[model samples]
Target: MTAWTMSDTGRSAAGGLPAGETAAQLVHRRLRDDIVSMRRRPGDVIFEKEIALEARVSRTPVREALLRLADEKLIEIVPKSGTMVARIPAEILPEIIVARAALEAVTVRAAAESARGSDIAGLRAIIERQRETLATGDIDGFHATDEVMHRAIAEAGRLPGLWSMIVQIKVQLDRYRRLTLPQPHRMERALAEHEAIIDAIAGRDAETAAAAMDRHLDGLRVSLAPIRDLNPDYFSGDVGAVYDRWAGEMA
Candidate 1:
């Protein structure tokens, strides 16, 4: 895990405070970013006083921040003991994957029908940028650029709203996907998959583009067993919460 310091805690997510953003919000963003990026690994203890001191704020705001993180399940708050970073709820990942794949496949299919020369050019440009970023060993930048590729595809398909929906559903999945970056050839294979999808879209083959996209997204689903096995500590053992959440969604 990457180490963060007290000095790093004072700054808000974007270098400075945005209008009306409070101390608690800033601290929450800092902690959330650290947790999601695996800088603060699963089961790492988080103390209110330490966080308060780091942010140069009273414990009230820090406590509030921690509570918010708990609500997101990014951190677990133990009433008597202490708070700790939450493990990945591996149970929910399959459902998340299914939702994303279904949505993205539709978007890619639509993009194949709607794609213009400019759209194709823009996607190719993103691919070039991803390649350049990956070459520099900036895996995070490469992954970010890869997301732009998906967003561009959604926009090209005239279904930009669906991309926002995708973003909303991907919060937990993002943390899991971040772990996949350093795996040998993971990023390369993803890039190749993107290329295949773009090729099909460029050819105006809607069905082929959708199939390529399904295959691309399915890669993450297939990765679960190996990734979970390799990093058992990173995942939650109890899957009941996932089943409960799904049932609640239906009700």
Candidate 2:
């Protein structure tokens, strides 16, 4: 696991905030991105002293940022044990996916009915950029573009606020998606699904577009199984039982 630090270039890759961004905001964005991208894996301790040193700021700002992240449930601050990245709770995943699918399905259907030719072209351009990112094996870049593409659909539907809601709901799902990104051909398959959804929307077929979105989200549910199997420690919920069984077997 590579340690993520603020760049010497004075610009961090938390999607490149404006010049006036505060140190606390910068710290929050960098750490949040690292957590979501799995660069800071679940259960990994987050030391305020180290982060403050790396960011060239005092521990006060770092502590403030960590408190914000804790509110988002991205990191847990134990009373005496310190802070660690929060594990994905296995039980809530289905609920998150279901909520996303419902909202996104409604969004895509609206996009199909209301999107202009320019909107369709813009989406196609995003897909092309995703291809370029895939060719270069930039998973992080691909993920960024993936987010842009979905947000574009919401904007096309004239429901830009829905994108914000989706963003909040998908935080956990984003972590799980990052976990699955290294699997063979996952990005390629996701691109194909995106193309299908775009085609349906471009054709002005609301039913098809909604169904395509649902199917795409369904694939996310399927992807979780293998990731859980590979990284049993990165998830919560049944982990205690699993550990207990392992201990019994060893005994």
TM-score of every candidate relative to the true structure = 0.84, 0.88
lDDT of each prediction vs. the true structure? 0.84, 0.86
What lDDT tens digits, residue by residue, belong to model 2 across residues 13-105?
663544988778878988998899888999999889998877777788799999999999899999999999999887677778878988998
RMSD of 2: 5.9
Best by TM-score: 2
lDDT of 1 at 3: 37
Per-residue lDDT of 1-251 in model 1, one digit per residue for the tens? Answer: 43345446555555554457788887898898888777788899998888777677789988899989998889998889888999998787878888999999989999999988999999999999998887888887887898899999999999999999998888788888988888899998998999999999999999999999998887886676667767878989654455456446644
Best by lDDT: 2
**Models, CA RMSD each:** 4.8, 5.9
Off by over 4 Å in 2: 1-20, 239-251
